[model samples]
Target: MADFVEKASEKITKLSDEQLERLLNTVREENKIYDSIIQSIPSGLVIVDNNWCITKINKSAKRYLHFFHLHLIKSDPVWNLIADEEVSNFISFCAQKQNTNTNEEFSIVSADDKARFIVVSILPLVCDGKIAGTIIFIEDITAKRQQEILMHRMESLKSLTNLAASVAHEIKNPLGAISIHIQLLQKSIKKCREGDGQLPDEKFMEKYLSVVNEEIENLNKIVMDFLFAVRPLKVNMTLSEPDSIIEKSINFFMPEFENCGIEVSVNLQGNRNRLLIDEKLFREIFINIVQNAKAAILSSKKSNGKLAINSFIKNDHYILTIADNGCGMDEATCSRIFEPYYTTKADGTGLGLTTVYKIVKEFRGEITVNSELDEGTVFTVQIPVPQKETMLLEE
Candidate 1:
């Protein structure tokens, strides 16, 4: 006891009380700053101790792990807590090779059959020339991957541009001629009625012209879809309110809803909503989703079809729910619902929902669909708002 006291006194006697207090305060401030930086990172971080047990996890880390806020301590193994077999294996392998740090991408699939693409980097934490622990940093690369795919698709389309022009010209030229001929026939029929007391086949002419025009319109839409699929999508983000955007979209489609004998409803849900999104792209998102609902309703031929849009805030995202009482899809169809050129309609361009899915993902958001055959369909859109949920911690 005397030796310990002598050593402690020798270490501290050189510094006055004021200097010791100042040193203690500086250490505390440094620790606070460190914790702030660790939690502020967008990537998920998991810290595992030398015993291969979880020591700490950040808000983002919990999200990627599909594990919400839980007070985990050093005694809990990271692999045991996080139930992904692949993730567990990776962590175990890194623990075995404690001296080596590694970075790898992992594809994690959840119970809902939804796939998440993430990149995991396992870095060994060094302390006093030995491995103290391992730090796992996870980042969502889905948006980056989506952009690469879009760029590839665009590149492929460039090779087909000449053929696109050729096909468009050939298709439109005949349609143009047919339109002109139909107009002339209509005029001729009028003249015949005036020149002689002869009745013309008004019903037959009208029916034939209607069919021709409808077919012409369908062809034009397909051509346009091809052109648009290749066109570069320019996204400019702005701070905007979701309810305002939804209102504008509802106004534009009110006439269609009424004409189609569908009832439309919109609930802003208290209206304190804001998200960082591309205004033009978000408006287009609304238009596509609402139109899809209309199509589903019309196809189902439901006498009491109703469309409802409700907006609210959840977590750190602005949630928009667009639901319809119409023809819904089965599991098989839902699997590839976001794929390009996947459509349920006979005359659909198949790009409407695909466009919506792409834009939502581009803005770091997600689209989820719930439906059953012949019942109804609901689309839930979650767009992240870059706002801190808490001052000291984020989730």
Candidate 2:
């Protein structure tokens, strides 16, 4: 390719004035075509030298920069346009690693004082086996992000509607039982009055009242769980070791695990770095997961059930995984496990995993479940490490 280019250059130099004029016109037309393509792109496009000075920018980029209170000029330092410290720092970091490509999303309050989400991509420009400059692609994703939030709220509203129907059904069963018992007690009292003016049997009264009390307690519990699943959470984030929280959650159920004959194993590798999360909420995540594992094992009716807990750090996120050798779920069941009041267990209120999902979201984390019928199930949770912790780890 290099030799072909050199030969073409030599030939061009030897051309007559008329021929050279035609070649120059053709080249200028090609440059115009290229420039038009750049200007037509919807995403903001910018080209900067190694010193972060803008060499070329497109119309979309110019308009986007104006939102940041920047009036761009050729050869201007691009960093000067960034008013948000966080965004500036990120750009600086990308500049330091210009040889590699970087993609990230950042939130900034624009000059209009409105919060906006932008995706920034930085790629190195290579010429003659040397880094000549960098290409930055900026995209405003605020509208897209808002739509996602709106969709999420709609889904939550749908879940709440389903929960309302489930709650009514759940309450009706206990209420019916209490009403039936009360009618039986009333009949017993009427029989006593008609027979010998004697009172009902003491044991009969205790038995019926006990059932009524138990049903009322169950009703109370259902309401409490429903509230917890739907209400907003107050997360108090503190730097805490995830392994310790995992251990504590496991220990809380150790007796039951032993009695159930489920062999439990834990391998913790994320303890070296601490995560900023609510300790209690984080523990609840594991507790619900572990409890589900135990239930799955019992349902499998296996003589020897194994539960494995593991944690590690990957890609600036702390990952925790729980695997159980139990009767796993089908795809349909797995998908709805996080829905409110959706459960297969005879006595399950079905809000345990829903709470887990909410807490993970509050932490800016993710939870996923993979399962196969009668084989096993694995639940994985990923929580992002704080920026300072990630930088220290990288260093």
The best candidate in terms of TM-score: 2
Q: List the residue pairs that clash in candidate 1.
A: 44-61
Clashes of 1: 1
Model 2, residue pairs in steric clash = none
Report the lDDT tens digits of candidate 1 across residue range 174-212: 587668768877787788789895756788577657767
Q: Which parts of model 2 are misplaced by more than 4 Å? A: 1-50, 53-86, 97-103, 108-116, 121-140, 159-163, 191-202, 228-352, 358-377, 381-395
TM-score versus the correct structure, for each prediction = 0.43, 0.47
Candidate 1: where is the Cα deviation over 4 Å? Answer: 1-232, 388-395
> What's each prediction's clash count?
1, 0
Query: lDDT of model 1 at residue 189?
Result: 79
